[model samples]
Target chain A: MLDAFLGWTGVVFVFIGVFFLFLGALGILRLPDLLNRLQAGTKSTTLGVVATSIGVGLIVRGWILFAAALAVFLLMTNPISSHAIARASYRAGVKLYPGTHPDKCEERKWKLPEDGEEK
Target chain B: MRNDTPILVKKITALSLITILMVGFFWAFTEMPKGSSVNVNNRVSRLYILKNVKAATKSLNSGNFFAKGMKPLRSDVPYSPITFGKSANLEDGAANVVTSIVVDYRGFDTLGEVTVLFLAATGVAMLFFGKRKKNIIKAQASLIMSVGTRIAYAVILLFGIYIFVHGHLTPGGGFPGGAVIASGVLGLFLGNDHYESNHLGLKLFESLSGMAFVIIGLTGLFSVNSFLANFLPTGVIGDLYSAGFIALIYIAIGMKVGAELSAVVDSMIVDTEEEWS
Candidate 1:
């Protein structure tokens, strides 16, 4: 019963993993802009990889489990690092979608208030 | 213009033809493995750690404290987890443990990653922070945005510090934490252009942290077997003092990354200034 349960859990994880991959692909295809696409790509892919790693851990069931867990941890970290890359890209003046609403960043200017006077 | 049009058209046609040919080749290679299953050797090697993992887990669960101590590091050499875990305990004095491993034990890789960050900061600085030859004046934002962002600044800053300090216990570490902290500064950059970072201090921090990284790597070569080896005592396992070399490496990486990212923000902000002369 326990063995069957483990096997079923493993199958479920694998299914989830495949589902995440499909979501990531769809996100990449459907997202409108570079930043939006990046958001979709990284989050979905990270979740997909983690799910896949967990599934592998269940299937292999040993030191390979530790390795799989490490892979999942790495997957989590990789996206944050990639997000930094994407943010850096945006700061470096990559354009947004033309029809998209004006960005908070593009319209905003920082200024100090002058002595309680309205300009 | 007329002559150039044909040349452009010819180039486009040739590029498309080559792309199609490449795609055809890829499709053909992908299908060749469809029906064929490569036989994999299922025989376990004597040294396969998978066999021992069960024993290790059992030892961990068993109440025999001394026997558990005798178990080898969970991860082997070339597999970084053990090295990171061992080193982090030794160097950082961090209690949660894993934070030290990622930051200190595999610090050289962390250094390379930091350099990538530095490069990114440089790129962002160049694009957004450079002195404007022409005055490109920006408009002020809505009160709601300005006020909301201001409130967010404090929250984000706190969150960044929380992430950095609690990195060992949780998923975040220096890289993520540093970026979070940088994001806080980015809030300031977006909200107010006049608030610029001190360039001199930023430069000093960037250079010093960068140098410290190199020095740390070199120290490993001189004191240990190879580069980035644990030159310090392993201490008692599972204690804060355990991973001697690892702790120091993590601290250095965290500080270096934090400072370097701040510098990146500084550079980007400074570049926004209009040329006075």
Candidate 2:
């Protein structure tokens, strides 16, 4: 009985994780900006992977420790990578939408260069 | 002007060529003997199968009567799986036949492969050497990245070590394990600019390991009367300490590859900086 319940729970988690992964892909394809797309891709996919791994661990024997390890690894790497991409894009002068209010990162205020002074 | 005719011709030619190659490969695959007859009724074991195979070869060779329409047979080198698969443990005290073959039977080939990697690394390092300024200040990674990278680096390094160490017993060997180790170094490079790796130490390790590999082979040649022979005592068939020379050679390869790859990455990173500067 306990095994069956655990299996069902694992199945549920796997389905939910797959759904989130689908949403992440959709967000990546549908989002307006690079940052928005990157955000969706990283956050949702990381969580989805963690959930799926944990679910697999529950369903399969001898994989629980590995699943936990992979989850920890994902947690360690994802945020940092996302931060890097965002920072790099910002430094490269990828503009955000003007409709968004109070752009704190726009404090630098990139001005149009004089015609001859372009690097 | 004449673009349409040429384009059409090129497409048709490419399509036909690809189709021909695919069909030829498919036909060859289909013509191959598909069944694993050995496992059908558990009748044929090691010695019997080998004997039968030999017999079959002899019979095929004996049939010299050629027909007018038949294609010429290219009977070349005979393959014997029983030699390695059955007597691997007996020969080298190694459980894995593939490992035995790589480390024992064809170690010279592996050495050549390592030398190729080393030469490639040297070429990359040379390309990056001329433009490098003494003690160039590198940009530091952000706080979040630094912390995360530190954690990831440790874990990856540990995993790489595990892979290299347990290579003899497991499916993974030195090449992949060393690549994993290099990835850890890459992580460190990403984490912080102040990641002070000892360039001297890396180079020294690479050179020393490569030298040790050759020296070990030479020593085997002198002592055991064969080049790259299994001279050391093989401890156990399946244990960690078993396959003495194979294990040592793999360790040496792992260190060399890891150091060389890390050096390559370092040089490449420097090369990129030169491009921007």
TM-score of each: 0.42, 0.73
lDDT of 2 by residue, A26-101 (tens): 9999988888899999999998998999899889858989998999889888888998988778666797756657
lDDT of candidate 1 over B1-277, digit per residue (tens): 3556778788898899999999999999987755447321122221121223334445446643244343333322232333334433223343444455455544567778878877887786655644543323343333444454566667667767667555545567666776777777776666553555676676677677677767777887898757775577656445545545554554455566766787766665553554432
Overlapping backbone residue pairs in candidate 2 total 0
Model 2 complex DockQ against the native:
0.29
What is the C-alpha lDDT profile of model 2 across B237-270, one tens digit per residue? 6777777788888889988999999998887765
The models' CA-based lDDT, in order, is 0.61, 0.76
Q: lDDT, candidate 2, residue B78?
A: 54
At residue B102, candidate 1 shows an lDDT of: 51
Clashing pairs in 2: none
